[model samples]
Target chain A: MIRSLHIAAKDLKAEFRTKQMLNSMVIFSLLVIVIFSVSFGDLLGDSETVSQLAPGVLWIAFTFAGMLGLSRSFASELENGCLEGLKLCPVDRSAIYTGKAISNVVIMFLVELITIPLFAVMFNYNIQGLLGLVVVIVLGTIGFISVGTLLSALTVNTGTRELLLPILLLPIIIPVIIPAVLATGKILVNGDISDISGELRLLLVYDIIFFVIAQLVFEYAIGD
Target chain B: MSTNSQKINILSILTAIVMFIAAYMIFFYLPQMRDTSGQLLDSSFKIFYFHLPIAITSYLAFFVVFVASILYLKKGTHNWDVLARSAAEVGSIFALLVLVTGSIWAKATWGWYWVWEPRLTTSLALFLVYLAYLMMRQAIEEPEKRARLSAVFGIVGFASVPLSFLSIRMWRSAHPLMFGPSAQGSSGGLEGTSLQFTLIVNFIAFFLLFATILAYKVKNENLQEEINAKKQALP
Candidate 1:
């Protein structure tokens, strides 16, 4: 586990030095919000309808931006035989998976942090249940990244890595996406943590299930 | 080779006989359904026989895929990989049939070809997951690498089937719950003994058909592998 943390730190150090992926993810998510705002210009005036739509919009931005970041997660390792170097390390293959998942989740959270507030500002919506929303976001992002990291490694060696990743990832992640969207909507509209307990539990279960599955299968995914 | 062909011939014959019996029972043997008010239901109700069995059969195929994938990963053998690939291909076909038949049934009963109901959405998700599985196989050239990566995908993709099955119970679904306890109540079960019997017959028929197709597909794949091996040895 500590080795996993060390690997994550190494990835963060590299990522922070360049900030290329982080910049693109944040900017891309902001653009998604901008486009949504433009498209729903007429509906923006009504707080009721805007609130109804905000949860879906927020998750779309997150999913799309997260896809961008995940596709790059293993692609970066391809440079300078960094993947080979990582594999040669004494730690287990699952350690690499955990490390990559951690970095992906951290990057996704950073992107969401920037995107969510801007989304509120542009949509002219007031935030409620901020704590609940954070809980939902954290669980949802963890679920997404757990599966996304494993699939990223799987697709990286394919000829159509970028195209194949989303095709393969999206359908599999439907369980995660549904509950997260529902919970986000509940928190944003009703501000009742109690109302979204079911969704939160579902998200939590999905995170654990997929994370464990990914750990067990990560060896085959990255094996030579 | 002769025995193998004979076995396949016997399975195909059995499948054809059972399928004919099922079709006859579905259309002619069973009485037409009526609502509680004694109004005659539309003939589209018959599609349920095909739709439910096909859906279950598809689930069976994916379960095979899941098992074969794990075996392939554990043993690192080519046969398990071949079996997984064959099952996934057949499963995707059945999954697509489930969607198509379901849509037709929906249009006749619900006045819409589709809805955002949990069952329908999850079925679509299931189909797309396997479709992605097949596409991923095509994207890779190396046989071993393709097998390993797709084995992982097959295992992960099968997780959707249980979720699809449980979606109706998990959420308030518009889809009818024909058997077992549902979230709404213990309603929506077939009323007549004949209806239940015909459903059972159709289930057997479809399962046989799935097994037949899967057998043929696996044989074809093995033959293809052999040809490739021979060509490689030519030099």
Candidate 2:
């Protein structure tokens, strides 16, 4: 566990150093928000509705941006052949998965932090229920990263890694999105946690299930 | 060589006959449409005999791919890889049948051909994922790498099936069966001997049809391998 955390911390530091992945994700997210605001100016004129849609918008941004970041995780590792060095280490392969998943989650959380507030200011929306919303994002991020990390490892060696990850990841992430979107949307509308508790529970279940399965299967997925 | 070819031809003919009989039973013996009140509005509900069975068979085929993928990873045998590919191809075709029969059923019963229902949406995503698997295989130049990579993807892809189903259910879709069929164990849908028998026969028939197609696909792959080996030996 300590080794895994060490690897995770190292990954986080490396990711922040150059910032290619983070920069692109942030820029693309801002562009999406800008396009939405410009095109749906009248549609989102109602501040209340915009606030309600904020959670959905935040998730959408993070989900797409996270896809790029996940693919890049492997792409960057392979470009420098760092995976070989890591594999040569005296660490369990699942630890590698844990490290990568944690790093992906952290990057995705950072992206979410930026976009959620940006969404609020853009639409002049009062975003409350912050705690529930953050929990939803974190759970959803775990769910996405769990599966995404495995697929990234699988696809990175393929001929078209970039094209392959989304095809593989999107379907698996559906279970996560359903509950996350529902819970987040409910919170966005200031709905009580009890009202969306079912979705939250489901999200938690999905995260746990996928994380375990991905860990078990990640070795086979990346095997020779 | 010609005599062996003749034997294989006969087997193909037999499979074709069985498929035709299944189709006949589905279209003629099955009821086509029925109302929600458990009343046989008309015999048009017979299409479901084919529709429901094909859907079930497609899911079964995907499961086979999943199993074969596990075996490939376990043994690293060429045969399991071939089995996975054949299953994927046949699964994709059955998936096509699911879409077609589903649209027909929708048009007859729901007054529209398609709605983004939970089941249908998942089926669509399954089709696309496997179709991409096929495309990825074709894009790669190395057969070994292609087989290995696609097998990995196939196993991962099948995991998505349940996810899509559950997700669609949790988040309501525009599909007519929004709440899904009653789980209260009521005779809400099926009624009468004709409807029940047709549904059962349809399921059996499609199940057999899938088996036959899977056999043919595997055989074709085997023959292609034999030809490649022969050519390589000659050179």
Candidate 3:
């Protein structure tokens, strides 16, 4: 656990010094939002369509941007032999997996922090139930990062790392994305929290299931 | 060239003979199914003879992949990796046939080409997951790493299948089962089997055919591996 924490902190410190991933991801996040707004600009007059579209757009932006940050984290490691150094450490490989996943979840949270409010401000949509929305985002990000991090490792050694990430990820993680989108949309539409409790449970279940499976098998993905 | 290959050839020939018999039974002996009032279902329903059987065979093929993947991870065996690869490719083909035939049946019956029905969506997602496994395999160059990584991916992809189905059913909020609640444990169940005897015979035939194809592919992969190893040795 200490070694895992060390790995996580190492990445976090590096991220702080360079800020390369965060800067690029923030820019990427902004562009995704701008693109979404421009595409939906014509429907700005229709509040109903905007409300319905807002949640989906927010998630699509968050999900794809998270994909970029996750891949870049590993891309750096793969290029600089940091991954090799980490693997040479005398620790359980699952620790490295957990550490990477933790840093990824934190990075995604930071990205979400920037983008979620930006999405609302840019689109002129009101987000209700801030607490509920935050909960939904946290759970949803966990589910996405858990699977995405594992898959990033799996694909890091491959030839087409950039393209293969989304192809392998989107389908397997649909269970997570679908419920998260629905729940977030519900909150955005002024629906009661009671309305999306089922969606919340689905997200929780998905996170736990994938988290366990990914942890148990993480060694297989990156191990020698 | 060897006794094992000779035996596989014989088995494939017998599989062909059995498939022909199944076809004969489907087309010649079995009559078209009729609904009430003496009205016959569309002749397109005859695709059921191949479609349903092949669908089940595809599921069976994926199950083989799941097993072969687990075995590969546990034993680190090249044979199991070959089996898993062959099963995935063959399974994807069968899954594609399912989608095509199911689409045609829908067009004949419902007058539309497609619907986002839960079963259809799950099947489509399942096919994509299968293809993703193959793509992942192609992206890796080293043999051992590719085997290990692909085995993990194979397990993860199959695990996601049931979750994907559940998620779709949950999101759609439908009856959850094709056969409704009342249909459970009843003789007159929902439309699981349209033409029961014909379906059974075809299933048997298709399963044997799946086995033959799997053996043929695995045998050829082994041959290919040997050829590659020998070629590398020549240098």
Best by TM-score: 1
Residue A199, model 1, lDDT: 84
Estimate, for each residue in B177-213, the C-alpha lDDT of model 1 and write its tens digit: 8877786774576788999999999999999999999
Instruction: Rank all candidate structures by their DockQ, best first, as comma-separated numbers.
Output: 1, 3, 2
Candidate 3 Cα misplacement greater than 4 A, ranges: B24-40, B167-188, B191-194
Interface RMSD (Cα, Å) for model 1: 0.7
Report the poorest 10 consecutive residues by lDDT, candidate 3 chain A.
Answer: A170-179
Q: Considering summed lDDT, which 10 consecutive residues are worst modelled in model 3 chain B?
A: B181-190
lDDT, each prediction = 0.92, 0.76, 0.83
**Segments of candidate 1 deviating more than 4 angstroms:** none
RMSD of each: 1.2, 3.3, 3.2
**Residue-by-residue lDDT tens digits, candidate 2, B45-134:** 556667767777888988999888888877889989888899889989988988987788778868888785655767787888788778
Ten-residue region with minimum lDDT total, candidate 2 chain B: B178-187
Q: Write the per-residue lDDT of candidate 3 for residues A1-224, one digit (tens) a residue.
A: 88888999999999999999998888898899999899878997888888888888888888888988988877889766888999999999999988998898898899889887788888886777888899899999999998889899988888889999999998777667777888998898885778889889988988898888889888888867
Candidate 3 clashes between residue pairs 3 or more apart in a chain or in different chains: none
Model 1 chain A: lowest-lDDT 10 consecutive positions: A185-194
B1-235 per-residue lDDT for model 3 (tens digits): 6898898888889889989988888778777667656687677767767877887798888888988988998999788999999999999999899899888877887777788665576777788888899888888899999889988888877866676446544554322242344322322222535356667778888998898898889888988999999999996
Interface RMSD values for the candidates, listed in order? 0.7, 2.5, 1.4
